[model samples]
Target: MVRADARENRARILEVARQALAEDGGTSMNQIAQRAGVGPGTLYRNYPTREALVLAVYQLDLDRLIDAVPAYLESHPPVEALRGWTTELVDAMRRKHGLGDALSPGLHQSITERSYGPVIGAITRLLDAGKAAGAIRPDADPRDFLQLTGALWRAAALPEDRSQPMLDLILDGLTAGTGRRTP
Candidate 1:
């Protein structure tokens, strides 16, 4: 178990790192330590490398997103749950876009894998539930769904005013064939 002071310092460091990365486009151990009101040595003691710090911050956010899945599933219909989760995912990607601006190209891949794996799994489970409930089209593929959602997120990340509309269109497509057609 970590000591109280250690845990406090770790939380401080993470918060500082997150803020620094979000606002400044990059963060260093010294910057994080200074922002956290700790010395550089203390920062190194908690996170030995920049990569380690970045991964921890990324995973922290990803875990929060994954934890929300159960609550969303419980409170919303399968299709709405999926739609809500997709919106959350776009928000996450926007956060990642901020982080990616701070991280090296190589580190970005690692962060993406660590963050997106569980997210994709949760989405797959949600899609499967929707499918079983006859809310999602029978021909839907979870991987394809994820890919399309990723594309939508990428489009949303663009500096345009149409992202939400585009997202709505995509969500409509996902549920298109699952319901009765009207004249």
Candidate 2:
């Protein structure tokens, strides 16, 4: 376990880095350290390079997103929880774009797969719940849910309001005829 002070410093660095990357698309370690109110050495001890820092920030975001799933499931019916997750996911994708072309194709694939692992698991759970509740098509597969999520990701680049309609359409497709159409 890290010391409390060290943990605080790391958390501050990650918070500052996440905001900085969202605003600037690319941020320097010096800037992150300065904003984090930590020395360059401290920042380096926490994250040795820009890539390391950026990846950590993105992973943190994905982890947070995945962690929200259980709460959503508890408070919402499965289809609503799925919709909420998609909306949250779109926001995450938008924030993730702040990495600003820094990731190479290979790195993007690798990182995306890693990041999507827990998310896919959460989605599978949601899909299973939906099926059990008759809120989604019985035949809906996790891969199909991923394809739908990809559509939401692509649609997120559109004006903010435009994405929801598309999400609703996809959700409609997912939930129809299992007797859970939202009318």
Candidate 3:
């Protein structure tokens, strides 16, 4: 069992690295360790490689996003909850894409592969809620929704950031024939 101090150190390091990498993807490990108030050895012991750190940060973000499904569903209507969730998801995706240079191609592929199932499960839960509430079409599929969300973050990378309106269109399509389109 990990001690409390070690857990705190790891959490602090991940938090610091998440913020630093958001501001500057090329930030060095020494810089992160300094900002995190941990020694270089501590940082290296926690994350043996820069790529490992980057992957952990991405995984942390995805885990939060996935865990948020239940809370979002409880707090908002299905379609609106989905909107809020998708917005955060797009932002996380953009950050991960920004850090693409920090990850090796193989590690990138591995992370995506490992993350896909959970992400789809999150989408499935959201879609299932909407379907049960009669807010989404019966034909809606989590895989297709995820595919379209890929376009969202990609379009978001462009100067225009048209992802919101694009998402509105997508969500509208999902709610079509269900009589749940917002007035």
Top candidate on TM-score is 3
TM-score, one value per model: 0.85, 0.90, 0.93
> What digit string (tens of lDDT, one per residue) describes model 3 on residues 136-156?
998888999988999999999
lDDT of each: 0.78, 0.82, 0.91
lDDT of 1: 0.78
True lDDT of residue 152, candidate 3: 96
Query: What is the lDDT, from 0 to 100, of the residue 123 in candidate 1?
Result: 81
TM-score of 3: 0.93
| Ranking according to lDDT, highest score first | 3, 2, 1
> Candidate 2's residue-wise lDDT over 58-177, tens digit each?
888888889898899999999999999879987877777647755556656767888767877988988899999988998777777776777676677766656788888888888878
- The residue ranges of model 3 lying beyond 4 angstroms of the native Cα positions read 178-183
Tell me model 2's lDDT, rounded to 2 decimals. 0.82
Off by over 4 Å in 1: 179-183
